[model samples]
Target: PKTVLLLFASGKLVCTGAKSEEMVYESIVKIHGVLEDYDLLFKDE
Candidate 1:
């Protein structure tokens, strides 16, 4: 099953419904990659 992500207005995130800690990390990484692919994430100079 896919994990659920709860994003807050304050820039906080909550990952839930994952089978393990590793799964949560993986999910977040995947999400980050997608955000980068779409230029949705800010890059630090």
Candidate 2:
């Protein structure tokens, strides 16, 4: 129940072995924070 590829809308993917949905969401939030901290976020829709 680990090591899988997550496909996204932009043809991007994230490989992870997260055990639970909460952990997955937490990882996503952490990555988002890192991107925001570096100003690497989209400006508009």
Top candidate by lDDT: 1
Candidate 1 lDDT, tens digit per residue, 1-45?
399988776667899999999999999999888878999776456
Query: How does candidate 1 fare on TM-score?
Result: 0.76
Regions of candidate 1 where Cα sits further than 4 Å from its true position = 43-45
Candidate 2 backbone collisions, by pair: none
Model 1 scores what on Cα lDDT?
A: 0.85
Among the numbered candidates, top TM-score falls to: 1
Point out the worst 10-residue segment of candidate 1 by lDDT.
36-45
**Residue-level lDDT tens digits of model 2 in 9-37:** 67475858888887777777777787789
- Model 2: which ten-residue window has the lowest total lDDT? 1-10
